[model samples]
Target: MDLQDQLKNLFPDHEPEESTDKIDAKPSYWLQDDPIICKYEKRKGKPITILEGYNGADSDLKKLAKDLKTFLGVGGSVKKETIIIQGDFRDKIMAFLKDNGFTVKRVGG
Candidate 1:
């Protein structure tokens, strides 16, 4: 079963009810521009990929990361809302973001 199905099975009374758009769905004053940040760090002297700047809920970020990982054919994770893949893909990610209509600016060196 899927995660949502599993959750519903665990808590039958709390089954999800499809409703109107969430308050956050609108362009609000509190929302940050959603963009994927790509960075490389050392992990025990090994290079590691860190994709950050995902500003959303846990499940939503996780789902986005999962889809991205599948498309990139790389192993990655959704950590604290950051999508950490296994390699540096700043150019690739920037292209993806642009194709999706998200304005992007590469921040770090």
Candidate 2:
């Protein structure tokens, strides 16, 4: 027998509780009404992408930053409620955020 068989034998009259979890659950990070600003800038002569205007918790913003970096296969960081990606990726970042249910606004070229 398997582990399930042994557990059933041990608790013959116990009923299994139904799980309330969802398989396709959305992201736990808070989504805001205001559009996230996706802007590009040349910081110290190096191109960088900045994402700001998030009204959620700092942890949520950090998680978003991490996700963005991972999804884009690039390096980035969360600073002062803003995400700083180490490249010009406005179009890709905006598309990714839109697919994930976020409203993104492109601020600059």
Candidate 3:
């Protein structure tokens, strides 16, 4: 007999319980009321994008940073709650954040 058949024969009176794990598997992150600042700067003649003003757990912010980097196919790092992207991706990053339910504020050129 198959595994399911064996299980049914052994626990004929047992009722299958609904899985609650799905409810807890949803990804959750802290949401802030203030918009996250997206700024552009030139360091050593190379353009870099900076995201700051996020008031949340550093781990969540780091996950966000990694997601952004992977989505944009670029390199970045997180320091002191600030996300530093290697290129000037202010527009793209802001759009991605907004699509993911985040408030983004563009600051400076």
Task: Output the lDDT of residue 75, model 2.
Answer: 99
Residue 36 local lDDT, model 3: 98
TM-score of each model, in listed order = 0.58, 0.75, 0.74
Query: What's the C-alpha lDDT at position 94 in model 2?
Result: 94
How many clashes in each structure? Answer: 0, 0, 0
lDDT of 3 by residue, 1-109 (tens): 8998899999999888988665653246688899999999999999999999999988999989888898899998998889999998888999888877789999996
What is the Å distance of residue 31 in model 2 from its true position? 1.0
Clashes of 2: 0
Candidate 2 versus the native: TM-score? 0.75
Residues 1-109 of candidate 1 have per-residue lDDT tens digits of: 8988889888989956798766753222222576556677767776556767767677666766676677678888776767777777777766765665555567567
lDDT of candidates 1 onward, in order: 0.66, 0.89, 0.89
- Where's the lowest-lDDT run of ten residues in candidate 2? 22-31
Best by TM-score: 2
Q: Give the number of colliding residue pairs in candidate 3.
A: 0
